[model samples]
Target: MAPEPTSPVAGEQQDRSGETQDPATYEITKPLDEESPLLSPTRDEEQEGLIEDGSVHHDRDETSETKPLWYMILLTISIGGLQLAWAVELSNGSPYLLSLGLSKSLMALVWIAGPLTGTIVQPYVGILSDNCRSSWGKRTPFMIAGSAATIISLLALAWVREIVGGFLGLCGVDRESEGVKVTIIVVAVLFVYVLDVAINTVQAGIRAFILDCCPSHQQEAANSMASRVLGVGNIIGYVAGNIDLPKHLWFFGNTQFKVLCVIASLALGSTVALSIGTVRERDASLEGPPPKGRGGLIAFFKQVFKSIRRLPPQTRKVCEVQFFAWVGFFPQLFYSSSYIGDIYVQPFLEANPNMTPEEIDKLYEKATRVGTFALLIYAITSLATNVFLPFLIAPSYDSPANASLRAQRGQHTRLSRFLDHLVIPWLTLRRAWLIAHLIFATCMFSTLFVRSVGGATALIGIVGVSWALTLWAPFAIISAEISKLEEVRRLRASSPDDNNNNNTTDQAGIVLGIHNMSVSSPQIFATVGSSIIFKFLQKPRGTPGDHSIAVVLAAGGLSTLVAAFLTSRIQDEVEIPEGVVVEEGLAAFGVLSS
Candidate 1:
């Protein structure tokens, strides 16, 4: 073990070559406060210090098996802030678009950018981050750039008409013409595309960053924490979304869209600042290490193919799970607001048969608020599960060598006997996901029957269990497989006689990028599919949204069950189950034949 630095001052240890010591001696050092910048690294400084790629840092070799509690806090806060900002637009943007006097077709057209950006931007960003050897660190620069672009696009989204008006005037176009309005909408769509790309960039960077920084064993825990923070962020964002932002905020702007965005900007910006202070970034080049690989844009496409050919079948299942899971989830997520809004839309229209257009707008806003509240319920339930699930999953053994933990009352008792075929963790990914899919499927199926806000809230809230699983489980399984692959590499490297001209390269960023494609693909499919379905099912414009939304949601429910089935086929990377809660889980057969 290396000795601790002897200096109380800002002195770093030097080797024979007069270079600062390696990561083996100190993981990272951060400046603590603004007055003493050396004592406290800013988020930028933290990123500037990230270790380069190639060598894996074994958590077992460290003094602690995991990052400090404060590091976790910083991670959750920063990432959570990102989720919240991102969620605000997601949860409320549809209603905002409707309010902008857009038809269903126009809104769908605008949404094309969402899936396109997810599909294109995320993977490419991952490749760039993987090969990047910048002094500012691989991931942070991208994240910072994304954040700036996203914020700018969001502001432009809020005020596109005004901004485009100036441009139109410069081009000698009449501001009052319909053509000018069409141009504004086009400009707005462009901004939305940019916004989607920007958000994707940051998301890809952060997801890879987590994997890069954390060791193998902690991947599940880190992912779960991220999921929890995501819930918290969504909750914060949803709450903000629910607020009845007045058409005019004298100090901020004249439109609710503009005002709410300014609010989101402040909230997102502050959390990012906090994250910057606490988390450390890596720069592997500091050691004057062997020159790194550079593939540029072409490298990304090559990495995609390499990942496809090289990844194990077990690792590949993460994509399958994600693809099907999100296929089920996207319809539910994208249409929830409209679905719930439609319920009120019909009732309001009937009661005030002669209601003015302005009054109709008011009623629609109320529907949106109701939908936003349901979204809030979903977020809270997700948070509750995220916070408590670790304990629920912790094995309770009758003895050290017991095969199964004692089944808690709900997990193993009478309920277990009934739904054990489709319920909670008896072990690794297979059983755990089976339960998640069943529960979520049940919730999705129930959406068809929901007639009121209260029922919808309860149903959606319960689905958070599966939502939590979706966030963490696949990553956990994939990371475990990756750890195994890394061990294989280490073994080959150590074997004197196992000489092979080529060895496997563990490019975590590339792997994660491919996995992200699995997620984004479903969103695209669901978006297009939903657009088609809603056109046929929806009531004509000027009458609420769509009331028979349950039909749309039922598809999602069925898809989740399919995902559950797919999960059953996946091979377990870790132990199946440490302990059996129900004695029935162990079937005893008669004699040798049994």
Candidate 2:
């Protein structure tokens, strides 16, 4: 027999039922069918109550649960602000390291550290949130606290820079005292790293929280919204950071950055609060801290480890693919900017020897702005693709297909075999698109060998446009397809004749987290690995490191085709679970025909 329902769990459902008789005293006349929605997705929440075999299971419909749209918008804005500040700092804050005289190698080391945290740290945070229990809700407290830390750290970084300058001055090393300032700068950098970790903690929590609230059928739409929000936020943040204040250069320094930090903090805090405030926390056992003891930490880890280990086979498969995909993609995170600077900017200057350093700097800045714009274009295009791709799958829009579409309501498509042949580019072109992108990325990266601004500019534009055309949409499409398959599985379980209508909600967060991990893990590996590789290839030390890294990037692009091919193998595994109506219908049709 399953464990008995705890008091907290009983009380929550009581409240949900609007002051009804105590759940303990209530009669369960209706059998809890597989299709009946759980009060919460976690498995433990499902076995609380069951009715006699003849009873019809009536679930409190999942559709009623939604955090308001404005709350979601606020979350989006907050995240955008944070991303914007980070991007600006990533681009401009480096002057501090250079001015303080850190070696290029050391600077790279510091840069590598950020991605390092993303690789392991984020998943840990995500897992923690998954099991977290607090009256304030599992994720919001972390979100608010992390935002506070980010604001404080951004201010501290600027102050640390100024303090180092002053200390060096007092020590009588006024001019070219960069070497003397390394220690102070390093300390500040360490602080910034702490801040980054905190912010990422909140980001991970927010993602899990979003999954927690959205129904399985709605996940694809939610994921699409997430992509759009991220892209929009980044674009806005970048544009805001790039705002040139000719009238108040002094204000634009630390003061301006500090102000932005405050705004970011407030935005995140408000958004987090709003996101959770109106939404009810259903799992009462999760409403307070875990039991106190030294074993608590150990127990927590044990639980998390079990959660990971016990993941269903499908989830594990997704994790493996994610890991490989991330590994192949990591190099681009650090290399993108460097690629622009070296392949285009430096080459342009070197070839135009007649131009002065000042002239080159001016031109390079212009070129970089253009490059940034290209990236923004790519971001927007990606958003559009994600929205439209679902319609093209397997005659989803055909009138006859509407029955399957409605039955798979949460699945969000009109047809069962939406994967048959894509419309816009055609479903058959899916693998081809993946191959083409890798080729594009490789070819674009190879342009580092080109020595002309004009050629480089043209190449950047092409790559930017191509990437923008489909990057966001492809993932959305793939995720939607898989999610729809999962939805079919859930519906099959809901059938009265089936014994396995399980609430599979817990899998969604972990799956999405793993998906993020695939994307992030590569960033970590690529950032560190590429930096190390480029270190050997740096000018004067090694021969044409920029070109070499580009070649490697091109290789990575080619490798993505391998991932694309493997995706086909994974595709067949994403079918409706056994005894699902879709599968049963097909079987019955086969029997009748025979």
Candidate 3:
């Protein structure tokens, strides 16, 4: 049987030629009221209206499905390698200059550069991917290209270090001198930063891909799958780093590291393959073909500004929270290792002044292993919280199918409602999760006050506990929110006469770009700020200086708390009608476009 139209939209509509047309036109600009993400149009305009029409039993067709468990594991392992490498770089590179004997001042420059690039790179790439049109498809091309670029960049970085050493050997420069090695190190670090941007661009694209392919109800599983894969990557990368491959293998030096990078590359490639192979997808027929206009660099910037200006208020609020959230997240991700190294390794070295170089290296290795152990715990906790916790929280545990059915009907009362009999308490719990996330940020800020190796290690280790909670809760909440937003948009678009005006994918990508900025911006601030405190300010020159580093970390943590409060406003924003006036006063300096 043919699907009926949502309204009388199919009977008489004009074509692009401006004549009374035969086919229904898809205009997507309608405001979605009380929308839900689980709902999607079956086809283009005609199919969309059919789903919207009450004539058919649309709810039967709108039910959610889950990806197989094995597929989730496989996909996670393939993708996790890159994150492992990322963790290594973040942890090791934070104190990279110190390891290379560069003065703290010079090392600061490298740290400052890492997150600065992220601030500029991730959002634009995310937005572009949303609008891209090609034979290969939107995201795959970016994924393939980004993976290839990341591989080349990593190889260049490893080789660059070797080249510097060889050059110093030829020039008769003191092999161990700070300047000779520092220059070489800085160059390599810069290259790594550039490559990292490319890799993250691919990562952001992959994230958007999740939002694109997975329907609203499946977002939790999708996000869980992503987190699991990240854990797999971390395990592989850390295990590889822990092993002294160079001592036993022929290519243990630069070659061994190169091989590991290659493994990461392959792993990232595998993620692309799995996504392409396993997930069903559809083209955004609404965007039409890619436009013919080719803008110059200046024109591109102009377009970016224009795009930013036109974003709706709810979209803008998401961006604001992200901006604040990333300000905390990035620094922690990129600098945690370095912070650990500085606080623990450097202090131990000073205490045992006569310790051999090999001993110092050994101690550093031990600390790293400890950190990795903490990370493993964190990953397990994240998986448990995100993957398993939701399953238990539904209306009741009669059977999985019945529970899911109850959730869909919104008739089944869950634990929160049963206990409190009020929505406010449940909402407060959600608010508290964000508050805890901010409090965790404060723990990061407290690092500036830490002076002893034990203190630093203990704090960093405890961080895993809070981290598990934050990652699980926020991700679960955000996934649900996005689903709600998508549903609302789809419903509005379902209006029989509504023109497909607002670019759904593009708008979504823009919001995600802003969201990722929360992840990226903090890296920029943390690296640059820490560099100033550790290097230029010369605070860590002694015990007193070490305390200064802790202070900086504490400030960042406090900022996280503030962000948690701000996240509450976003919850309210989510309930507002789409394209409506976003509540004012919450607006930041940037003007929000309608």
Candidate 4:
């Protein structure tokens, strides 16, 4: 529903000296407490028709502070650097498990734990941060804690096997005993569990911080920068994972896993420190009355549920769009390497039916490398797209000098503005999905007849366009829309008896939580579904003439086609009727404008 029409906008303000001050020249030296971290005290044209229609006229102050571009750049690099380390942790997981003789099924359980922990933990953390009034700011403490956990988990993961072995020897158990094997299994699972929880915390903290601090207009830029960084991280991680570490200072002569874990610790720890240190926030608290919700864990879950119930229409729609989007994506992320590797090796297996298990493992390793190389190409393509596309595709805007012109024009309002923003980006996102899905579909089916490293690389690189959008766009849309409501709430806050606006802003954490719910819900399915297909359908490594790997890949391609269809059908923006401004004055809002 469209928000209630507001009273006429007040012009000019009364000065402390009993003079009438021009609205354009007004300054807000003091902050608006309980307002958004992203909201500037001064009003601008962009805020005028935020929904592309009428809204409460904000304080007419032009003296607003702006964040520097370098701040955003440093934030992205730090996150990207952390991703580089985190991705190494991810890429190394399966290999580390195999080295310890853990089964493929155990590896599947490990992967499933990530999405599970993410779905459960991130929302609670987001809610906690929203109401937190710590001196360092809401998000920084979480980021620091999560990073600390990541470092500890990595070091623990690296040395736990040896630590257990030494403990067993101390207890008079033989080093060659089965009890030692059970100890490795126990420690590995526990460490992986901690690592998963910690990583999710880091991602949630950083993401919320970005939304809290970045201006609505610049959100697309920030998200795209992060996406680009994610791509870079993937490349770095894969390369690092592939290296054979020389037997040096690895814990108890650790394998490649030790090298990766140490690198993960240093890279993630330093980057997280740098990121939290670089950005200064509104000094530790929002300068307003605390939100109206009852405090504590019960209120926390209640608020999350209530917020999910009351999400603005567009946020819900985006979640639906993403339900389909990730259905195709997570599968590819989980299984593309193994699927493609099996396909590439099918012919050799057909010719050498009786190959030894060692020889077969060698062949599969070579195939896996091909898959990794293709992923590198995908990462590079996504990076290039993320860096360059937004500016190239962005709309012409009113300059700072003409801050009020857009609002004054009255051409678009309310739902129209929402729709305008939605339509273009919606179309762009769907088009990317369509093109990428087509490419994916083509590659998947094509593999049945002929498989080549070049073909696999090309296919993934093409899909990277959609992948980049997936990483950036939904959050972009959610932030952009909710920020408008925030603008409405901020103005209303200045008006006594306007409790509804406060309620709207209270929805922030829950809405973001539901958005994550949508993200993880699909992963749960993909993890289970992909695991079934990979384990049951695909042939065991080194065995035999053929397997269902190509068939499974082709099925995922078809799923993407369906995902594209779902995306294309969404109506991207809200609808707002043209509003009639009845009057303008202090009494218009039952209170005087500043």
Candidate 5:
């Protein structure tokens, strides 16, 4: 009545008995009523396999097979480098632009580059990467090229002043002239835009790469690992930003910003290399090439729009959440450090009524570093949350059957058991995301009351918990939905009576691109809106009681509260094929099987 196993699956091997055995299965001679380790695998052993390539197997389909732990780690680790670069930009970009003689409003305008590039470049790169037929693989070529461009742009941005000065000197123009200053600013802005383009390309490619390689069952774990790595990168970047780098590492550069650029370049370069070198990406040539000519281009655009229109309900909800969450996120990403720096320097300004301009500037610079330290705390807290919290909460998409099995096998600790029995039944991933949004909103509103540097630091540090969930939850949810869709496609393809050839599974790249667009498009409005806020609320440099940053943050807080409400509206659970079980226990949290 059933088809026999033909060749061995990915992890199957012939045993001493000359029969293929799945690495994931074991003989259970004992009755179900008896106590037996064979009932369920130990959590540590399952996690060890996940982390250290413990023998595990899925179906023969490449898309469904579980990769080694090392493979997953290698696949996602480069995101850390990307995050490091972004962290540097977030912590220092505004300060650097100000040093280039841009006003607060103009600096906000300059930040428009990020959203603009993300909106255009991410989807474009995603579409291209999805169809790429290169031998180096669809994502790898883009990742390599993007990383190179990012490094070049980072260096260019860091030394824009010197580069402009030298060019002017060669042209027989005065280096300190207004013309040279304007040229430097223009060049810096261009480099910033270039950096955004490169970063977005790499980001889209890497996210797609993960989706392509990780099967549905492993999606949450893979994403959580990526989040942890990103947290590590942010920690490193913030620590570097907070330090007086020029003082400690003069060989890197004469200025802190220059040294920070060099450090980010190295970090990004090394990680990108390691990831691309070790991972063997599947050739996408089999997927066929992009259409050529004007008609082809028109068709591509039509397809993109069609895909957007046909987004799954879950993916659409995730996008809606992302839109509001990112709107709240932008203010913190762009201004948290700067806001804290302002708060830190206010007391010094009050104490020294007659401070010299140079003295005040030096104090502000010191205050910025203090703000960077607060970001360091934020990063550390985020890292810890990513590492430890998953064990305590159930993962998204976990079935009740799997939970019951884990309980029967005595896999949960007392704390985990209590959460499983009482807390987690109600604390679904969507609800957890709702709570994170509320937490973020609370922190943002708290900024209005923060007068001391320590208070600001504490507030930002608390925001890290929300940041971890934001990084992990939405992606996990989307990936699971994508996986489900893929499973449906596989089932359809296998069904002999099925004649629906039009049901093409959605490409991860395009879905992620759409997700990215949602995230970025809002920032465009947020940036312009913030620029308007700064234009109206920003006091002149010496204003003693300016609270413009707080106002902007409070506005962001209001948006986050809206996000929380939207998060609650998301459908946390979806029906799957009956008897289709995820071996990994606790779906949303990526808990190991019992």
Candidate 6:
């Protein structure tokens, strides 16, 4: 017979009934000391896999402190690769589609594939990875498979026209035929869908891997490293988007989009391979097979619904804020480049009224590159914000008691002391998030008055501050709440008189998945809404002054205003004992860490 599963701590063992013995029941060989680390409430909480730094520790073979700094860096670099691909897509996808003769309205519909796939693929992959029992480990196999798919789909998307043309030629179809054009567009759309699905799978697996590998104490550091790497990737991606790649690197591809795809594929494949090769994952098969029947699609959705219903008040409020925030973010994320490009092209269109179609197309491409430069500015500002914002805002775990302890210990450097003096004590994470929402709303609305490329660039660059906070704050809030929920579940489990037996489900994966749903579901609404606006409000094709994209941006601003109000309503403060002090570590957003 198989041996009973053992708990991480030495004196804790699973009973025959599969329940952990109460801590009170465990025999003590030595007299307990009041100041003993084992007896401390903070230590108890850490043992329960909940860290105050907002890093969720699930199951892992080693502590992050035991791992070398280089190892942590390598492990987290894959997320940067993921962000690079995403940045490239967000910066150039719409322009590439327009180049292929797709209408602006239809282009919005095509973009819906991202949120649609994210809604289904991310959660399903999260659940699936959780239950995986492969020799290569639960997360490794999925990351490898997802990375391969992403590389393949990205290449296919980049070369879609060539692929479709080759197939049409083989079938003796005329290249100039309307049918041929429609077929090429259809293939490109399908490839975009596949690419989005593959990327989502990789993203979900990478995040789970980080949580599973990092120990309780170092969760914050690991996450911070990942975030910084992601920021680097964003910077590189936007910079590349701004450059004239065809002029500088003709060997990579004929067009800028194709070259970016090749670069992203190489970056993703190499980073994933490096991490997979260097990291020795624990064999999950040793954990025993996943619970039977829970792997099915119907069961998955049922669990999701159950999780949604059981979300904690704090988590539910965070989700509400995220929903509206994403509604505000979607238009800027997908359309800012196009919006700025349209503005840049307006004057040129008037100056060259009798320009040829090819000349007009060239002008649009040039204007899009300028817009891409603006996004580059946005990326740079966001990276700077991610680096400096942590010191300016108080951590979620910080309290006056902990502050006094840090001060007594002489741990504050001169810079930190100055920052502390400068920081308003009332500027908590929730309030900063609220401020970010307000900034985003104001910037989005500012587009209504922007007529020059410079003004648009300035507005977008300012939005970076909000973007950085958006990337960090919600996840931090939700993570703390989830950790609290996990503690409650553990407390109930250890209670002898507690009769509830259905608390076996892992709260981290389920709640995080639900949070992801909140972020993604709004994108679907935003895309559909933008499409309708484009259909009705956009000027005719080849018109000189189309402000439909601006209109969508303003709508997003309105949604962000709602998010700001909801953010103000979220309760973030909780009382902590005077002696307990959890160290402040780096915090970052979920997917794009830095």
Best by lDDT: 5
For model 1, residues 1-594, the per-residue Cα lDDT tens digits are 111112111223344355684222332222111111001111111112121233333222331234555666676565786786577577767777776567665676577677777877887887777667766556777777877787788888888878989888999999878898777777777888888898888787777766655544455666777888888888877776677566435477776567767776776667766665556555533423322456576766665776666665556776887788887787777667766777757777777678887888888778877887888888888888767665445321112222122232122455434333332345554566678889989988887777787787788778777777777678767764454343333333333433333444345666677788888888777777767776787665556435546777887788788888888888654321322211111111000111
lDDT (CA) per prediction: 0.63, 0.46, 0.52, 0.60, 0.75, 0.72
C-alpha lDDT of residue 183 in model 5:
90
lDDT of 2 at 285: 38
Regions of model 3 farther than 4 Å from truth? 1-79, 165-183, 239-263, 283-287, 291-294, 307-315, 346-351, 355-366, 388-429, 445-455, 465-505, 536-545, 572-594
Model 6, runs deviating above 4 Å: 1-44, 47-72, 216-224, 278-282, 399-423, 483-501, 505-507, 573-594
Writing each residue's lDDT as its tens digit, candidate 4 over 385-477 gives: 666555333222222222233345553466545533433322343355455555656666665665665676677667667677777767767
Pitting candidate 3 against candidate 6, the one with the higher lDDT is 6
Between 3 and 5, whose TM-score is larger?
A: 5
What is the TM-score of candidate 5?
0.83
Clashing pairs for predicted structure model 6, backbone only: 227-593, 227-594
Candidate 3, residues 177-241: lDDT per residue as tens digits? 77777677777877877787877777766666666555444554556566656655665665665
Worst 10 residues of 5 by lDDT: 31-40
Residue 236 miss distance in model 1 (angstroms)? 0.7
Name the lDDT of candidate 2: 0.46
lDDT of candidate 2 at residue 493, scale 0 to 100: 35
lDDT measured at residue 547 in model 2 versus the true structure, 0 to 100: 60
Preferred candidate (TM-score higher): 4 or 6: 6
| Predicted candidate 1, C-alpha RMSD | 11.8
Clashing residue pairs in all predictions, respectively, total 20, 10, 37, 13, 8, 2
Off by over 4 Å in 1: 1-64, 169-176, 246-250, 287-299, 395-430, 483-501, 575-594
How far in Å is the alpha carbon of 271 misplaced in model 5? 1.0
